[model samples]
Target: MSSVEEFRTAFRDWLRADLTGEFARLRGRGGPGREHEAFDERRAWERHMAAAGWTCVGWPKEYGGRGATLEQQVAFHEEYALADAPARVGHIGEQLLGPTLIAFGTPGQRERFLPRIVAVEELWCQGYSEPEAGSDLGGVRTRAELDGEEWTVTGQKTWTSLAHRSDWCFVVARTEPGSTRHQGLSYLLVPLDQPGVEVRPITQLTGTCEFNEVFFDSARTPAANIVGTPGEGWKVAVATLGFERGVSTLGQQVGFRRELEAVIDLARRNGAAEDPLIRDRIARAWIGLEIIRGNALRMLDGVSAGAPGPEASVGKIFWATWHRELGELAMDVHGAEGMLAAGEPYDLDDFQRLFLFSRADTIYAGSNEIQRNIIAERVLGLPKEARP
Candidate 1:
């Protein structure tokens, strides 16, 4: 076998050995019972992956990574999905903050933050979506004022995922009051354990507090915590969102494909296997997932070649729509059983939670509407929308 093929074979074997034990333990807990201990389990798994030098496989060797090739990184993600590993606990750190730091952070910043990120020692959350600036990030009203050597940030951010459990947050705040929407913003790394920061959990429709509202009243961060120059936060924020919408979507596509396979298996076991409509839907989902996988690969290739583009918006839009369709199809196949809660005596209740969570995929990381607009403007060279 070729070197890449050999590496893939070895990696797959190792992942199979490691992930089997973890998944067996998880499956024994019944259907998706990681609600309470999810973070702990994810942290442990991340540590295990880090020890195997696979946590940040695509990162440079200088930054404590294995420096795996793009193909190897893709293989790692594929194997991770096949093994059904628990979703990451610190996605904000792993996906958004980590990449941003790698690009814009100083050597000291990288040394201080990247290692902890790999080890999951410091959980991170995003402070981007304020109550007034959910979709229109340019309208962010969070204020960060320079006070001598420190920047005191005062504002409220809503729908911050895992803010209650996070140790740090990467925030965007207005540093120049008189400047227009996008120009005055600056990104700040705010530590959440301070006295001025308050995190209140926001319960979802499923009665789970997976997200929080973070209120920053005179939150003090050092001048060193600023990312890039003052008033360049909009650029940093866009870069972060680019990673959020692209690289993060690659990881999620793996899990979504696994879920799609599970739905197929569930349908087969049910009487729906003989239904033509169900089979057609399953086939369509498979094809759509393949398209997403292709798009992800293309994006990775572009990144490797140093020619990254806005094609990630296309992938994001496609995967979000495909995931919603998959959820709907799974629920339809489950009939009434899909509606039951996990603790109930039903077999397919896990799909209920999955379905509800899929609703947020389109809205978060820039709404699908915003992504469509981006594609229309940037990809299609369409006329720009008039600003108010």
Candidate 2:
């Protein structure tokens, strides 16, 4: 086997061996809609991953990582997903903010933040979306002002994933008064534990409370907490979005493929496979999984150039649509039973949860409409959408 293949083998072996004993319960526990499962246990699993040097493998060795090559990083994620490892608690810190810090952060910033991220000692959330600014990130109105040795931030951020569980947030705020759109913003690192920060979980249709609304009323971080420059945060924030869909997406597809296979199995068990339409949809889902993986690999080529570009939108729109459809397929395979709750109050079964949560798949990272606009204006150089 090639070295990358060998790396994959070793990684897979480690996962199989380590995800046992107290950790065995974590297998297939957390992912997408199931983020609410095994609350404390999943956090422990991430710390365990850190201790085993499995967390943040893509980070540079100097930042306490394996400095794994792109191929090696992809291998680890693939193996992790195939092993059905719990969803990581530190994705925002490890994948998104860590790289952003390395690329745009001052040495002091890197020294203070990167190590904790590698250790899973701190959790993070993205403070990008707001009530008025879903896909139009440029419309962020969260404002921050310098106050002596600190920057006081005030604004509300909604649909912030895991904000309630995170210890810090990388926030995009308007730093220059009267600035609009993407300009005059600053990427500030704000602590979530302080008096001025409030986290309110937003319950989803899945009956899970993974998403949250975060209120920052004069939340303060040091003056040096801003990444890049005070008024140039939009650039850093956009780069962070590029990293948002990186090599780990290849691994995501592995899990997605597994979900598709399970739905197929469900169809066969329930006799839905006998129906020509169900079989055709299953076949199409498989083909769609292949398309996702191919696009991710192609996008990986852009990593060396510093984050995937606007071209990444092509894959985003494709996979989001595919997964959403896969959710529908899961429910269809289950027939009428998919509509029933697993328990009283608000409990949901796997397929039901998948169906409801996948509804947000197209909306979260970026809405389908937004993704198409990026492809048109940025990637294809087409005419821009007119705004009021």
Among the numbered candidates, top lDDT falls to 2
Candidate achieving the largest TM-score: 2
For model 1, state the Cα shift of residue 388 in Å.
1.2
**Candidate 2 lDDT, 226-318, residue by residue in tens:** 999889998999899999989999889888988888898899899999999989999999988999888988998888677998889999999
For model 1, how does the per-residue alpha-carbon lDDT over 76-126 read when each residue is reduced to its tens digit? Answer: 666665666666676678768888899999788898899998877899999
Cα-based lDDT at residue 249, candidate 2: 94
- In model 2, where do residues sit more than 4 Å from their true spots? none
**TM-score, every prediction:** 0.90, 0.98
What lDDT, from 0 to 1, does candidate 1 have? 0.78
The clash tally of candidate 2 reads: 0
Lowest summed lDDT over 10 consecutive residues: which window, candidate 1? 27-36
